[model samples]
Target chain A: MTTTPLSPTQRTTIGRGRNRMVEDRAELHRLLDDALIAHLGVVVGGHPVVLPVAFAVDLDGPDEDGTLYVHGSVAAGWLRGAADTTVCVTVTELDGLVAARSAFHHSMNYRSAVVIGTARIVEDPVERRHALGLTVDHMIPGRDATLREPTRKELAATAVLAVPLHEASMKARAEGPVDDAEDIEAGVWGGVIPVGRVFGAVVPDADATGPVPADVVRRARAR
Target chain B: MTTTPLSPTQRTTIGRGRNRMVEDRAELHRLLDDALIAHLGVVVGGHPVVLPVAFAVDLDGPDEDGTLYVHGSVAAGWLRGAADTTVCVTVTELDGLVAARSAFHHSMNYRSAVVIGTARIVEDPVERRHALGLTVDHMIPGRDATLREPTRKELAATAVLAVPLHEASMKARAEGPVDDAEDIEAGVWGGVIPVGRVFGAVVPDADATGPVPADVVRRARAR
Candidate 1:
């Protein structure tokens, strides 16, 4: 965790004006874990490309802080488009919309982390398996244990890339709107419209058999 | 609306399995409008740079389709780096997390649109004013009219980029877990966990303001 590769960027520097930036590693991990999806940005033929991809967090290991793993189908043009290129990956959660009296100040109060690093293709067989396990477990806890292991063919169809979570900055603005002093007296609706993701109960399909796993129930209930 | 630039490589056909892709102009505009933020993917120095940016939908004209308008401080490196270059913009809303019997089938149901096009700066005063108005109205209706207009200096400090809504695709997946017929008998808690954005009632600040505007109050309550 002391490695410069894993150190979180300082709030004062990376996240300038927004004084509410989070610099702690735990906070950054929490945001990454809670993120259901990530937008993968990569360069191809001198053009910038962004792709929405599923991701899993590897938070409990020697490499926990060293890097965050992302994987995609080998057929993915996005992955092939950016081999050995540096990328800036970002995750954002729109907490709410801050509605202020003046237009210049109105903004979305959000929690976001921007990670800058080069992506390296994972090569070691052991590491590749670990990455795949983390990827599957990210979507459904306890799934790796319950399902059949991927065959060689399946592994060939996948490609894993590791990006160090260093040079990262997390900034957020959560308070209600900061209205101008004079506009505060202008009689305008100025405050926050709290917006966030809400989870609905698990909807079991009609054809499914067997009991729900404790892990699924736990995560769903926690939400 | 039907211009296709010749590329040495073939036009990437979206996966047949993922063929609900939308190419209609109206559908693309609706998807972009619903999204408050977009991941702007641009290339800088041969690397992929993806940054989260606030954006508004600029309807091209009464007869034209529309364009996505994204603006930022003139000093923002990510924004400024993209001047006159082609960029990829993506807007996504994760509707739910789908859990299936097997890990391979687990997926998420989301609505996302990817726009790949050339970036052009909005420099003309008339178009700049129009873009600014759309930007403000996109965040909060009528607030633009109520606030002080942007002075020349403020306008000079901001840069707006418009990416035409013409060449784009909107792809959405909304089904529950797609478990194998045989695996459906494995008795797993497999279904969809719905998620979405919720807006709360507007909470006016305590600083002694005038009455809330009728339109603002009406919209807040309506939400």
Candidate 2:
């Protein structure tokens, strides 16, 4: 099925650097899939507070529109204030560091997705459970199946919010650093050094029932 | 040298979760140094905007306080709007994904530094150049010495802002996921899968005049 792209508004539009915009809906999904965490921006008391939270995107809807899921503690109260207000959720994957010979041209090669939407608080008990399960499964496939679902008391302590992925945009810079003519003639080492995340040594918990599960072992290699 | 810790307003205070608070100045510097990118929060036109930007922290000041430098193009005007406004610059390093048997207990092991301060535009050309040098060298050491300095025209096109580290605080969670009593008894595989960044194969520029320099080669290994 063909997916409609996210329509951009004045804030979502990349007016300054147009070349970095990624308009494809599928590409946005790919970028969000790889992101381990997302920065949720909310205006509190006339100031902006950006906090990192474990996030997941639900893509099973008919429009192929993405639904961003984020959760925090009731005590933290970050999501509580976010209800009904406009919020910006951004995910960035730093692909590499661009080392241009000219200091002015030095840059980073990264893929970022910016989504602006209203934060709809998940108040319904049924929807809350779904969002929580999606977060666990999104981070690690087969995780939700293995683990027990959230209990009523556990769900009461958690707060989840959803943002429609309709008004979103992805911006990426993947090419090598472009050094100017004079700097190239000066003979500096100019290139792109790829930067990426991978799995480090696993630390099993005290309650681990067996060796690392096969799902985790496979996920490690892919991560 | 001992640095005076940041005085917190009601908003910056970690009253809800005081256990995650880090008060040491030296530890905050180390957290900022390890961040791949920082999310800069600014309130513009009654809305909050969080954008990822390359950033550096200079801890060589006499007071042993860090000065954060974040640069953007004059055209984008992000850093421009930040002048004289309260801004929040946050750097997060995701250490691992904490997998708990219960969905509610799933968490992320991360170290995040949040600096809330008023931005001061770098008007002095001398200080501007120094901050830019520190940024480039901090990301990739020894490259600034080789590359040509920014010309006046180039310098004019860039805007850099400085936020003192005095009001900054670090919040980190570095333990295994906390599974509840019932789920721990359920005997699901619950543990922590460490996550971190590394360098992929280097891609040299097409016009390279010599082999990749020793610094870049060394940088790749440590990346």
Candidate 3:
């Protein structure tokens, strides 16, 4: 893990709840690795549009800090609009639901990382293939090696966009409810309800298939 | 359960995967209700910014259709930038991870709702209180009723923004992996690993007295 501190640009700086901001680069990487998807924001027709997309991060990438890769169909309008333009990608993992004595203090315990930078449409075929493999492996470790290589036609239909992780910032809340002293004295129940993603039993498709692979089983249980 | 079809304005129209768009208003409402958090996108300094926030929806509240309420501290810069301006709010639930024989066909089964409209800062005291209560109970059902009423000072420190749901659209993909016939003939494993949110046992804070409430237990199990 790199000991480099996350350099938050002016836009990426956390304005509110400064106490929640984390400057550790490793922490940002951990948050991004744990998250399954990211919300990508781009301006379309003078309006900001945000959509969820599966993403994977490359720590030793060619970008300033690293590269965050997100893919979509070439026909996707948002991807086309985001090309060579500034965008914001956010990944959040809600750890728990904090139940406070007062409604105002109710909050969610979460770790979120926001990356702001220009999105470049990757043109190099070699890098595109590498990013695709990273994306697949990031979702299911070791599963990428088992899959067949993408055909030329399949590559033609996909669009991969890379955003530099130079201006990333992470914020997290991991504590119990912070309630007023008066409310605590009032004897109201207050605590945290832990929340996490659970992977259920894998169901094979109707098509002919062999036994589920060890990698898939491990991924299911690892969660 | 309004029978009204989701009116997709010119901008709300799904451009890439039109078949995935759902026109039923009830489907949009259901997607919003099932999601605990939303990624709110707003343009700041000519760049798009996206952040996750806890949100609640009102099915019959004032607006062309209904209202989506998100609360934050009054000092939040994003809340101030979003006020009286067009913003995009997206709620996405990743249902399952679609694992295919080929990495090209690998995808995720998800339900997502996107709402784009002007955000009006809530001013009316009664409406603000109602929205605050909804935000609280939406996180943990029956939670607001158990907690004491918010003090005047607490309400003054909060900022609630409402976005109308008139321009909302929902999209969902809920099927097994769609793979090429050749991959199936290759005898490769392909299926969907179901994913969902799991809530763990509620841990009471040190200051908390008395037994955990029944509502909290029910909420934990209901998840």
Candidate 4:
């Protein structure tokens, strides 16, 4: 398989009227890596469907292209139909908004990535195993070794799709709103209302469990 | 302007391969209302488009016959197209998954609402005012009164659409996996793992030198 690095496309633009689109892979990776959940948009019967799913990032192995691997049941209607089909996967973090004096200038300060590409299903056993390993590790590093291996039957039912980080665009807005020079005279309550996510202390299972995993503790606190 | 209340005929059911379907409005409303954000699926050029947006519930002023009014900007292509067009709006919250002994029975515990309808644009000033109020209080309850009233210029630029909650169906999977009788006999590491949003302490604006509002405090802890 040829690994094609993504280039900025004609559709990626910044602001309301198409002003600031960032096509850098590093910026795209940063936004994707930081996001725990993503909204997956797929077409079913000509109507659009969007589903929020937990995803894992694979930065190693045959997926040397830094592919984002998302999986669901092989029987899942959305996943089953997505294979070899162009899918739009968006990861958006609304960091803040530039509330400007002019309604025309109102814009959100966000870090968003739109990946448009054909998703291919992982078929090989080795690749599937590797993908599953990456997924488990990404969800909770070091949990793969502790969890029981999937049975043959379990492997048969699972489905994993790989969407290359190629064809992706990352766009962001951070500065205060670009108010019209004329609008500046209009006293409006305008400023950046920052948005963020915070994780609380991890609540360990109350059952007769062994000592808490250090990795889990560290990651939870970091969040 | 007509406010239509959707009956069962307006509802659509999305089924898994063959077995289950849920059709309930109360369940749908709770799921949609609980979510902090929604990914609106719109189709452009016969392709699927999905964008994340914030929405609020309008409870005080019913549209004619107690229909739930969901409002947004007229400038928004999605909202504009949604009005008088067949659209699908889905709201989902993945609480967790309940693993079971049988792989086939492994299930996620989630609350989801999928509404299919044509949105109506509210042009009447009296109705529009109430819809705007709902949108404002939906985010910050008392802020509507505290903030400056919208000027005619602001209102002129804004557009609000209302989608009735009538023709919506809510589907949920909230219990432990229903493993087959044969699988139930087999021992497996199976149970539900819960997930949800936990709001942090309310952060007041640094410049807001006044006492913390009671409404803000109540809403923060209510969540």
Candidate 5:
């Protein structure tokens, strides 16, 4: 794994003209870390298929550039077909709703990262187990520590894929909506409405043995 | 324009090992309506390309099934190439985080709609105008009534593509984490933390602006 920042390949470049590209590699990691789900796109059965999946990044590795770990049941047809193939994982965080004076100029202030790489299924038992641990920790800081480690049978039932984060790029539009010069005087209200994702109150399970874990409560309140 | 409820083709069925499929048409509509952006996927340059775009649905249409309107600059190379080609538009709403006792069952409570159809670039003057109107109205309800409608030149500079909502399906997994019986007694807390997307205070654009428009305030508050 290359610890260096991701260098944009031709495929990762935004070639279509609206150049709202983010050049920093750290920004890409920030967007990915803050995300809960990623839209995973793969060419399946001769067409493009995009599905949302839970994902985590491997920061524990010594490499500066980390791998994205996405897991599912071994029996998932999509996961089975996705391995050893190019997959595009996209994470988008919409910051604000840009309300431009002109309808044409209206846009959203969003930060989006697109990571394209071949997903390789982890075959090594030790690596798979570690990846599973990282998956839970990524979603919640102190989660994996408290849960029971996966048994050998449990591990066998799951499939985890490691996607290298080499070919990646981030694009964002993060300012107030740009209105036309003439429309500024058109007496219309134009501004940006901050769009925030926050975690609400915790809903305990029906048969929980105790109160919500301290870490869960802390993370939810922080959000 | 098919007014009948959308009839799913073979492609829309969930054939994977674990099926959290939703067969309700109304549920699909609800997910699409409440979303801010849809990841529109089309094979571009011989690879799967997914782009986030602002979209609107035409429920007011005579067809029982609706259409998804996604607009972009006419100069956009991808849009020009995407016309009359099969496209997959997916809208996802992450409702909560399901923290199962075991890491394997940890999942997200989400509602997603996937629409597969050939996107048609609107050409007819009337329909093109209507599609553009739907695009703005979808983002901010009752917005176009206040802002100046697109001029002839502005309309010519923009391209709007309408993808039929006929071949569509919804899938969701909204429940508490499912942990094993043994893990339940292991005493690690298991529950759900509801995730909510809310709009924060509005930031008015520079220069002359009256009070924030009632409609904008209303939309922001409703979110």
Candidate 6:
């Protein structure tokens, strides 16, 4: 667990639902680990553009707080535009659907983390290679070790950006619906439908030989 | 099926992966329907801010093509900042994790749709009510029919923004990993681990009475 509290700048601070704001740094790390994809927002042509990208977090890396790595093809316009610019990276896990007695009270149970910071392109070869390994292993642990090293040409074709996790905020809602007393007394059925990601069977390619690796199988069976 | 093709503006055109660009208007509708949440990107204080929002798409609504409605508390700063401004709304479904022979080729199979346009606040009471119903039913089909109508105060406390689906783009990756011939011959495990959202059993609220509704049960059992 990190000792530092989430440093929410003027914009990162929660203004509306203050009750849902989370201050524990450990919780922020857990949410980042659990999320599979992050919605990265960057300004393009003076307009905000959001795109889904795979991400990895380096909890103990050299940064004010930590480092968040997001990669894309070097040819991606968004990646090129985001370098050295203030970007917002948001990761959300929808836990459940909150059904309330009144349509006005319907809501969703979710955990979302937002990191606002300047995204800098990783130039150091060693750090870029490490970030690439983390990105690959984030999806399936221990699988990166079995893969061949990235060729110099392949490394040149990928762009990895690192954003410091300092200016960040997390908000979560995990409870049942809060309906009005009158609506509750009306006897309308209300509950929560839990939602989660499930991994299906691992399908090997036609050219793949031998049994699926143990790490891959374990990841498939997890959760 | 809709007769219109997606109008890709200067920014909406997919520049990096042209092969993954999906042009069929019907595919766009299907992707929007399958996705549960949308990442709403709005410029706040001259920085791009993205938030996860529950969204509903109306295929025959009044607009250039159709209307995409997203709602939040009236007190939300982002919602207020987004009014009458150009906002980018993105919805993505992570279908599978593509594990390749080389770490450089690791990727994900996903379907994503991006809609960029000016967001207008829905002020018409009738249209607001209809959009509210669509938002509720978007979570669970036919759920709006069983809930109590939103009171005037509740309606006043909510802010609903509509963006025309005219400037939009859809991209998807569905196949196995594209590894190099050398990597394939090396015989490293390569395949796709399918990822999907699953709904668990419904947990009724402590005050909720009677059996779970049929629609709720059906939704829980879906996928």
CA lDDT of each prediction against the hidden true structure? 0.69, 0.81, 0.88, 0.58, 0.81, 0.90
**Candidate 2 structure quality by residue, lDDT tens digits, A1-223:** 3456654577777767888888888899889888889998898887788888888777862223757888888777778889999898989999998878888898999999888888888888887788888888777777777766567888898888888888788889999988778778877778988999988877889878878876666666776
Judge candidate 2 at residue A154 and give its lDDT: 85
Docking class of 3: high
For each prediction, how big is the interface RMSD?
2.7, 1.3, 0.8, 5.0, 1.3, 0.7
lDDT of each residue in A74-181, candidate 3, tens digit only: 999899889999999999999999988899999999999889999999888888888888888888888889999999888888789999988888899999999899
Candidate order by decreasing TM-score: 6, 3, 2, 5, 1, 4
Per-candidate alpha-carbon RMSD to the true structure: 3.6, 2.0, 1.3, 5.2, 2.0, 1.2
Candidate 6 residue pairs in clash (backbone atoms < 3 Å)? none
> Model 5: per-residue lDDT, tens digit, A171-202?
88878877778888777778988998999999
Poorly placed runs, candidate 1 (over 4 Å): A3-21, A60-64, A140-153, B1-18, B61-64, B146-148, B206-223
Model 5 clashing-pair count: 5
lDDT of 2 at B92: 95
lDDT of 5 by residue, B1-120 (tens): 454444367787777623678777878878887898988787776677777888888866523386788888888777888898888888899999888888777888999888888889
Ten-residue region with minimum lDDT total, candidate 5 chain A:
A1-10
**Model 3 spans > 4 angstroms off:** A1-4, B1-3
**Model 6: how far residue B56 lies from native, Å:** 0.4
**DockQ-based CAPRI category assigned to the predicted complex of candidate 5:** medium
Report the TM-score of chain B alone for all candidates.
0.85, 0.93, 0.96, 0.80, 0.93, 0.97
Ranking by DockQ: 6, 3, 2, 5, 1, 4
Among the candidates, what TM-score does chain A have in each? 0.85, 0.94, 0.97, 0.84, 0.94, 0.97
Q: After superposition, how far is residue A30 of candidate 3 from its true place, in Å?
A: 1.1
Cα lDDT tens digits, model 6, A1-223, are 2456774577888888899999998899899888889999999999999999999999877787889999888888889889999999999999999988888989999999999999999888888888999998898889989888999998888789999998899999999989899877888889999999999999999899999988789888986
Collision pairs in model 3: none
